[model samples]
Target: MSSRRRLLTASSCLIVLLAVGGTVVAQMEAGDRGILPIDSTGTLEIDGIHVDVGGKDAASARYAGWRIAQREGFKKLWAKQHGRPESEAPNLSDSVLDGLVSSIVVDRENIGPTRYIADLGILFDRARAGELLGMSGEVRRSAPMLLVPVMISGGTATTVEIKNPWQRAWAQFRTSQSPVDYVRISGMGVDPLLVNAAQTGRPGRGWWRNIIDLYGAADILVAEVSVQRLYPGGPAYARFVGRHGPDGEILGGFDLKAKDSADIPRMMAEGVQRMDELFTRALAAGELVRDPTLITVEPPPPVEDELAAIQPVAQVPLSGIQIQILTRDDAGLNNAVAQLRTIPGMEGVGVRGGDKGWSILFVNFRGNNVTLASAIRARGWTVSDVNGTLRVVPALQIPGAPSGQ
Candidate 1:
């Protein structure tokens, strides 16, 4: 890769954040259990269970006891970790437990009347299950994450509590357990409305600082969610954009499949759970420590503590869409991504499939086409969006002068 600088004045094409719908975790197997490893601390999963009992039928007896045994297993694991008796662990829900289980191992079965016993290895995506068990590892008070949840419904965006269910959920989320310090404005009392869904595309950090200060937060996470239902009162597919509030740089994007509108909040809440993990990982890896240039008040000096080490994370799934840059050379593409990262919440930029004269870079960013385009415009880049596909070029000189509106 050449580090050559081009005489490109600036690109007018706005940054594009794709709202990916459906299962957001890439290559994740069907159902709730994650095939990949997520964590190894705090919450202990009940894996490899060997229980034997006799009932009307071996299968039915063993099946019936599965629930009781699962609860028992969880309690046992909790007791081992917390030094409390099995009876001390909080009662857990069967439905919740069922979701965390990934692969079940069964072998060496013996059957009897209404009773069956075998070996079972019940795996779990401990990252998600731990929350249900109220077993959050450790929390840090270094930064207060300002929550700006914007819900887009009926083609309109809202932030006020009455209309935005996403924001409402964030406000209600118990942030005490998580490492990230969370801050949110209820839009109550004398609060001046400054941020909306659209401003996330702006290239500069000017607008974000005010919003951060409005809620007295150290930083901000713009939780942008778009909900679409095929039929009224039916299943819903939600697209989530988690971006930095400072510069609208995308931290990550994901999709949620909800049974219906009611489930949207649950899915969103889970999405937030992952978002916290991502942030925690970044912090643990020393990737997202405060930048003094970011805020007027600097974050407290980095405290060497055990909190960061315990917050584990899985392979972060990226939700992406690509844009074409007319200049595809190594330097041009590299510089393009470099510039993009300066915008704040950009997750990453990479050449995914192929590169023509136009660099086909998969931009893992947040926000929609409009916000991206607007941000590009702010940077003085010429942008063209045709049905959500973006093509951008420098404003200085082109053979045809950057075609398409």
Candidate 2:
């Protein structure tokens, strides 16, 4: 072979290798675009509603099915809330029902020529529904709990590392009805890196604390689902376990079976509901409390600057004195208020009213207005008497100079 031919062959191989590497990188990055959760925050939701209705056409049949679903969903909700039978639920007109219903989620649908058969989720306006149900508008929720859904399939455990049925089940679970305050994260961007299946097994509270702080959650809940398939595209069984905190203590576990691959979604959705029940029971029993070991309360840094500290002074023990603070913005007004509170003899301070331009402050000082004025002046503020009320102006901010010097 010629030297020139050998060089060309080497170059061709290098180009092919680079192209493959680029393709691999692109595929890896594509995994970051996971399914984002649909937020169904304050509404009362009823899921697993079965609707089947026939009409002149598909559209009409779907419409009829939805109307029927609303009626069925309301009955189910009423029965669940009042501990009564569906037959005993109040008969409300379509007009009244329309006012209360928020939205209808079609879980799965089959539209025939003149028939509509579907599983649906109905969301009702909590405030509106509460009136009819004799329930309160306010719902008591648990402290924020970070949900780490772990699914084990084909001998591999994964969480938000990739889009999966287990994660989707939890993301779609309506938390408004449940007392457990679930903090679900979209498995996108860096979430896959931070919250993987391995993170759940870690026994370190320090690492858990960082995760809690990042997600604004007080604790963590590890919901694990292990799938066992009997055959390809055949029956499947899933075992679910609810674990809590950094230690990953098991709260409860359950088993569910799916008829086929298509039924896996429904099974997962049901699993979510069952897991929620387990958590709710555990919470009421005080088993779902956040681990105290995870809490790291940093002591507040001490202030040692002379200006920041209030000088010791004799107390006069008198009533509050009225003062008007002059400022251009809320920051200036807040700074002025903070400074005034540092006065040695100040008992209490309250802002009565005012806009961004100014604020009316009532200062309860142990000393008289005269003494208070002297203390205010010492704190880089201009004080003047306007009738009986004292007027205070914050220290001027000079360019390239320290403020309140």
Candidate 3:
């Protein structure tokens, strides 16, 4: 072959090799770490410290990897496809890198950069892996849009109060921290009356349906229906009840009783507290997955110096005082003495030269007065009542200044 042609061919081969190598490296780097798109039906399991995909035994490693890639890719693609600005889709190379780390840990054949390998082929417990990841099991699910409904039911007074106390209680739920798209309150005032009347074939069945429709379905329901209203005596009381749900199926429930109106708030608070506790427990138990949006981080505001706004000022009393100013800047020293001469007392002021940029002031407090001493100290100035002679100095004066002398 001609030398020219040979050189061209060699260069072409080099280019091809570089391209292929880059593609492989990119693929390898993209593996393992990511927010895997978990199946709504899939269960999560932990074998030791590793989280394994559960639910379907047929889910292969390659399938899992593809799912992760598709999920990560779709997030990018969705933004672009929807004509989102480039800034919105700025390359998420870090997220892809995290996926790579996770893949290495989960992949059985090639345990790449992960700290340890996990066998995910069989049933893996999500709760166990969540503990390892320092994440609640609910956080493992990829759906940012899904809402888990929780129901609250208790005494009518506790649940029916217009204040919606259970709403505050629901706020205490750990999963409640997750984005809740909808909150439905049942057994609250008219809703319960309407619900019970509807159940009894009363005239308000349609009205109850409208009420349900108006409030929508709750991801969590807190019902504080007065199982029994309190009377003057004789053990009258109310009960607080709470329930969690997905598509209206109650995941869990709790109940507590209140003997008085004062006990209502206490019981409500406890009910809400318990609801939160139970929600966290349910997440740990693999019963609920958290919304991904809740994991989103907000950028912090810029920091400002705390002292930037304040200017330092010093004040000293000149009552019957003879002052002396010593400074390298003779003009500044004279100005300071001039200012001191204007004070109420008939004291005279004088400036004298000192080392570096320091100055000294001497004052004779015609009488040994504590008020003058305190007034000088109040201005953030140093005052020394030495033998009834008041010496004033700036608080931040240089170390060798004669103020302390």
What value does the lDDT take at residue 18 in candidate 1? 42
The TM-score of predicted model 1 comes to: 0.40
How does each model score on TM-score? 0.40, 0.65, 0.24
Worst 10 residues of 1 by lDDT: 1-10
| Candidate 2 lDDT, 260-320, residue by residue in tens | 9988988998999999999999999988777888888898999789976878767567778
In model 3, which range of ten residues has the least summed lDDT?
1-10
lDDT of 1 by residue, 1-405 (tens): 111111110121233444477435443122221121122332344533568666676656966656656666677666755787878788878876666544343424555777776654444456766665565646445477776677888898766534455664565344544566666555554332465555555545555676666668777667788888999988989888766646655766778888976566557656666666666665576555554545776668887778786777564344465676666467766777777666544577777544455666677766666666677667777778866677878555456643532
Best to worst by TM-score, what's the order? 2, 1, 3
- lDDT scores of the candidates, listed in order: 0.60, 0.81, 0.39
Best by TM-score: 2
Query: Model 1: residues >4 Å from true position, as ranges?
Result: 1-139, 202-207, 289-292, 297-405
What value does the lDDT take at residue 6 in candidate 1? 12
